[model samples]
Target: MQTTLRRPVALSGIGLHTGRPARVTISPAAAELGIWFHRTDVKAADPYIAARWDGVEQVPLCTRLVNEDGVSVSTVEHLMAALAGCGVHNAMIEVTGPEIPILDGSAAAFAQAILGAGVRRLDTPVRALRVCRPVEVAGPGGALARIEPAEGLSIAFEIDFADAAIGRQRLSLDMGNGAFVRELCDSRTFCRAADIDRMRAAGLALGGTLDNAVVVEGDRVLSPGGLRHSDEPVRHKMLDALGDLALAGAPLLGAYTGRRAGHALTNGLLRALFATPGAVEWVECDAECQRRLPGMGVRLADLAAVA
Candidate 1:
């Protein structure tokens, strides 16, 4: 069965790149609506932007969705991940600004809210994208993203950084059975100290603070209280991958592998997946198949074990 929020939930914070304050509300929608964004502030232009891969506009650091009227919303990956991770199939996200909040630089707050608000099962059967064969995309600097046949959605990620505090890290996880809530939800986004100035020079990361994102400098972790997990960077990468993959607009039963891939590469991989014929097929999930999908058995109590 498909699911939607039992009630509306609202969150507020500053945007990571825009550095502007915004308030967002996640409201339940009818079955098959999938996920969409409405810019409440836009009065003259079309404010509705489909949260689909085709609407994605390649941007640095985060995923941005632009509608046909040029209306857009940015930094949507975390919220999207929370929705997908919580088994939310239909939602209308209302935002007052051009970006989603960067709350805690992870999906924990979003997941907690959705779980607390409760998920209501819809009458319609859930449909999923089943990867039939290997489809891959490569970006500059050797970044790679690939998807292949799998019984359930799983992620394998590897990241390497020059900063000693975050050198090489790798992790793989089967995202079914609330594993996302247990293992990946609390991992915060991270970056090296050396990149801060560069990002600011590009007019980005303006709202970034030590409280929201994990900051590392050489061998030291500048973010207070350190990481939530030993391999938090890689875990966060998986989290982002899940969110980007969610743009498929359906539950995906496939194994995703990322090697130094970011938002753009993942979106590219989706574009490639849909463009390549015979690479994927749409199938209505059976009872057993639904059981294997992410968020199938998620419960509010799952939050107790998360950071």
Candidate 2:
């Protein structure tokens, strides 16, 4: 069955890159509406933007969606992941600024709030994109993202950083049965201390602070409290990938593997998947198939594992 939030949920914080304060409200939409963003601040141009692969505009450091009218929203990965991982099939997201607030640098808050507000099952059956063949995309520095056939959504990610604090780390998960909420939602975005100055010089990460993100200098973690997980950086990467994959416009039944891949590479993989003939097919999910999807069995109790 399709699902939507039972009631509206609202959040407010500062954008990680724009550094502007914004408020976002997630409201339920009719079945098949999918996810959409309405920029309340835009008065002259079109305020609506569909959250889909073709709408994506490749940009450094974040996932952004631009509509035909050039209206855009940035850094939407976490919130998107929360909605997808919570089995939300349709929603209307209203934002007061260009970028989604980087709340605690993780999707935990969003997931918790959604679960608390409750998910209502719709009359329509759910549809999912099933990968029929492997589709891969490669980027500079040997980065790669691929999706292949799988019984359910799964992710395997590997990341290597020269910083001793976040060297090489890899993890693979089935992603079903509340795994995202329990294992990945609380993992915060991380960065190397040395790169912070460069990002600031480029006018990015302006709202970043030790409180919202994990900052590492050499072997030390500069954040007030330590990491939620030892391999938090890699886990956060997987979280981002899940959010990016949600842009496929439906739940995906496939295995995703990322090798040092970032936002652009993931979005490229989606484009490749759809553009390649016989790479994917949409099918109405059966009862058994729906049970294997991410967030199918998620409940409010799942919040106990999140932080």
Error of 2 at 86 (Å): 0.8
Lowest summed lDDT window (length 10), candidate 2? 298-307
**TM-score of every model versus the real structure:** 0.99, 0.99
lDDT tens string, model 1, 6-101?
A: 999999999999999999999999999999999999999999999999999988899999999999999999999999998899999999999999
| Residue range with the least summed lDDT across 10 consecutive positions in model 1 | 298-307
CA error at residue 134 for candidate 1, angstroms: 0.3
Stretches of model 2 off by over 4 angstroms after superposition: none
Instruction: Name the Cα RMSD for model 2.
Output: 0.6
